[model samples]
Target: MSNPSSKPIGLEIDLLETQGGKVPLEYFHKLISQLQKNHSLDHLSASPASAGEFDVVYIILSKGTLYEETETNAYECIIIDGWSCWPAGFAYLLVPPNRRREKANISGGDNGPSDTADIKIALLPIAQTRGFGRFVIRTLLSHAFDALGIRRVTASILCPIQPSHSVAQKKQVGFNTKQLCWIFEKFGFKFEGISRGALMSMSVVEGEEPVWHDVHRMSMLITDYFQEKRSLSLSAMRSFSREFPLKVVQQSPWEIMIQRQEKEKHDVESWSKRPNDASANDACGNDGEASDDETVLGGDEISEK
Candidate 1:
């Protein structure tokens, strides 16, 4: 709960940095080892810990912010021991090579530029309940939308069929599927659907076999991101400490506000250009739209976890 400014202490590292001799792979190994030892993250899906598994790695530092950029500073970031340069959490994005641009038919017509990517984030137990998650998410989404030109970002969260734990044990575990969904929704992600039997259970019960579990799918479009930015109050923006600079391309609070204003103007123009028939269908909910009952059923998927 500390981090009053909600500013993220982040360091960006390319997995290729190991091969380039910029940073050694052993540092990353230490990070993964410490992350695996944290029992609180058992409920979440395993991320790309190995060098070959992911393209980029964003390391969120602890206590203070990252200032200078040096090999020693980078090594300190990876050496997460919960004391000096503690890693609060990590996040990454997987972008397919030769990805084709696709239209995001959110408003019945061509809204704006659209592309897609997938994201994953995990935080240490000590970092939770603080503003670390918010900072990480804001940075990731900003990178995806602004730098990468990604219009839609998807997240598939693991939802266990039966979590092995008592009431007390449950308290120590990280956010469940429902809590994660709620948190993501707060960040403008919409519940897409659930993939049945998408992942094997990460929990282990003595003498019991691991069971297949579903994955909750959610997404945030560029429009949603704009809306989220517009809804935030100026005071909320000020709460973010600008002292801790992130290692990625992120918009400032004032920049976000300016972009929001521009986007609002663009939206009005786009709305005026939309075809009448598409608008009618949207109003009537006639284009294979989910009924209220079906929507309720989808919402119920997150009720358990």
Candidate 2:
């Protein structure tokens, strides 16, 4: 990321971000299209691209970093991280009109914010299981919570997003859509109501072609997401402490000398508070009075003199 003034290379020059917690719908579309062009490594056999369906996407390199292919350089940070394919994905929040507070002007059109938005991820084969998708989703949630001040973000895993080779032909093994759902659930997204056969095929399906599959909607509140993250961090710290006990510090020579001096000063103060007679009694056990033993010793000393 560059200074907020400097424009990111891949992003459009005029893409507008909203005051409330979301990318404006139009600007969001522009970014999604840009990702589709630059990072979407969809195979030919994959189901036809559906940009309208998914609002967020992501692409992470299996190794090494990639630079943005650009004509000029207003942005200095051109390197896309190998670990997180962040610039690829998109997230949306949809809210009722009553809940909206964001306002922005884009393409000479002004718009207010909404409560809910959809997020999607488009992964290259190398980016899929390395937990890159999880990273993208988590980043989007952070943006929604901190930047957009959103109530919740939604995720829908439609069957159409799956490539045909993995699902039908089984040429490659792929994670089930519900399994993907669990990843977000682990991040505190709730398993919302499901829409069975909600995804109707826009094209005519002949013979054994499957048209519709269940779509799962997962959602997370801003507060709950942050709270869950804090809890997990605390839990991890506790577990680590249990596994590796903390060692007491070894004091330096100066610190040891200072501690000994303080102890001696305390002892002096305690001794000064005691009465002289009490101290003598404690030391000689005569209560500051001469007893028969003392008299005998004095008489013996006189006779010797």
Candidate 3:
């Protein structure tokens, strides 16, 4: 079932700039000026077909100035100024999937980039729960399959352990490997295998030696993405249209996490105060496992330019 609106997602960078969200006038000017000054689009030359440590320099901004009209459109101020504003967040696409290159420039034909995988992601702490992660990745899928003509996208992630926190003090982006993997799952990614000690610790305390955590890897094909999107749209319509007031329940895609968290917290508090009867125990079977999982990080990746 396709969306009621018959528009196939148009996701070119130029079009994304206008419709996604408002990039500050100054920021937009600065980004274009910098790209012009540095001719940074050359970074796109890393054909997925060419492997074994290629270099590409990228510009990233620390300060995120993203605006919104509707919730699903994920526009960014993508600093690309080659810097980080907050110590914890910013998003960058590391060595994008392979491109269909011309024969004169062809090296490995189809094998080199066919299975290309490095896609690292992170976001500002404030931005994580707002559904920016899903929006950005969704846009990326469109760009990868439609614009670049990539057949598939593979991601190797260092997923973090899950967390539990009180309502007031919640953990923002870091060790959110699981959160990232979860979103990827919805958008047609499958869990592969975990690599032991594949990632160093995310702690910053003194006298803390680096602890090893496993890395999680996943991949998705363009065909799967189309199927997933169709299913999700149909599910949304069916799930909400019958029971809930469709007009009143309208929300940005990102608010799902926020609303769910509020519901979970209310449930936990309600149960915690309830009488310690078998009925209550049966009803509250480890509801503590449900916590905020909207936060994920996209760490920096260095490649040969």
Candidate 4:
């Protein structure tokens, strides 16, 4: 079976209420079936639509109150669809900024941005990997950084085990294993230090990552070395004349033969003048003759003493 989460597709985020007052029970049943096929939903308490039936019942769930203390709160729900391998699912959750802070450890410190807003995302188990999580994060960042002019925002991943750390790493989001510190370093979150299990951020702002100038400089040096080596090799092979007037005249055939005859005559004279001793005999034993197999200089006939 194809993993629906692996499919590459854009997510469409819309308010849950836009569909109608209550979605048909059949839609919920289809969604539950899809989730059952793709993921483990044993923790959820979904009931059959009717007695002795397997179909799921449709229900409208309230998220959070719009107002604080008096039960007025803004309710946010997500309806995700268009996944090729799985049916659609709905996730409804309350996103009361103040109320959420009271119950959860939302970052609202002096180091944290004062104007930033808190947004919570709830997803059905099957819809977690179908680009829904990324879409929600991008949306939150756009609103915090672009719309509200907020420098940074924070989020709390509610799952007992957050498996999307790799996904966050791909997006360059910074992680702090400390409490209330899921800081997106791309938007100015910084490593202040370690706290509990999360990282503390002293400041948050959008900035470029540090560039490695030394790496580029080293690459240029290597390139220059190769270029210089090539130039030296080429110059060694190229023909060039010296500027000085020193000349080497070629010896004529007669001049070369005369020099050879003089050398042989001197050798014979030295051998004859030697004392009749064993050492002298040994020295002249080989004779002043070039072997027949020896190479003669510029002549076809051997010289006769």
Cα-based lDDT for every prediction: 0.63, 0.51, 0.48, 0.37
State in Å the error of residue 165, model 4: 22
Per-residue lDDT over 1-305 for candidate 4, one digit per residue giving the tens place of the 0 to 100 score: 32222323544434322234344445555555644554333212222222112111223222222222543421233243422222234433222244335345566744422443433333454345455554454444444444434433433332222233477652332221232233222222333432232322212235833221100000112233335445645655452333344589999999999999999999999988957556855654457565434644534565768
TM-score for predicted model 2 compared with the true structure:
0.47
The residue ranges of model 3 lying beyond 4 angstroms of the native Cα positions read: 1-89, 95-108, 111-113, 159-175, 199-213, 236-305
User: To one decimal, what is the Cα RMSD in angstroms of model 1 from the true structure?
Assistant: 25.1
What ranking emerges by lDDT with the best candidate at the front? 1, 2, 3, 4
C-alpha lDDT of residue 183 in model 1: 86
Candidate 2 stretches with Cα past 4 Å from truth are 1-114, 161-175, 202-210, 248-305
Give the true-structure RMSD of model 2.
14.0
TM-score for each candidate, following the candidate numbering: 0.54, 0.47, 0.42, 0.26
Give the clash count for each candidate. 1, 16, 17, 16
- TM-score-better candidate, 3 vs 4: 3
Candidate 3 vs. true structure, TM-score = 0.42
lDDT of 2 by residue, 1-305 (tens): 12222323332111123333223445445444554564342211123234322222322222333345563521122222223222333333333333332332224422545566556556533334545555555666776677767677777765434334445543232245656678778888899877777775433357756565467788877778789878877887787798899999999999999999999999999988956455655665766677667787884465542
Better of 1 and 4 by TM-score: 1
TM-score ranking from best to worst? 1, 2, 3, 4
Q: Report the C-alpha lDDT of model 1 over 38-98, residue by residue, as the tens digit.
A: 6434445555553133244566556443443443443245333334454555666765332
Error of 1 at 38 (Å): 1.7
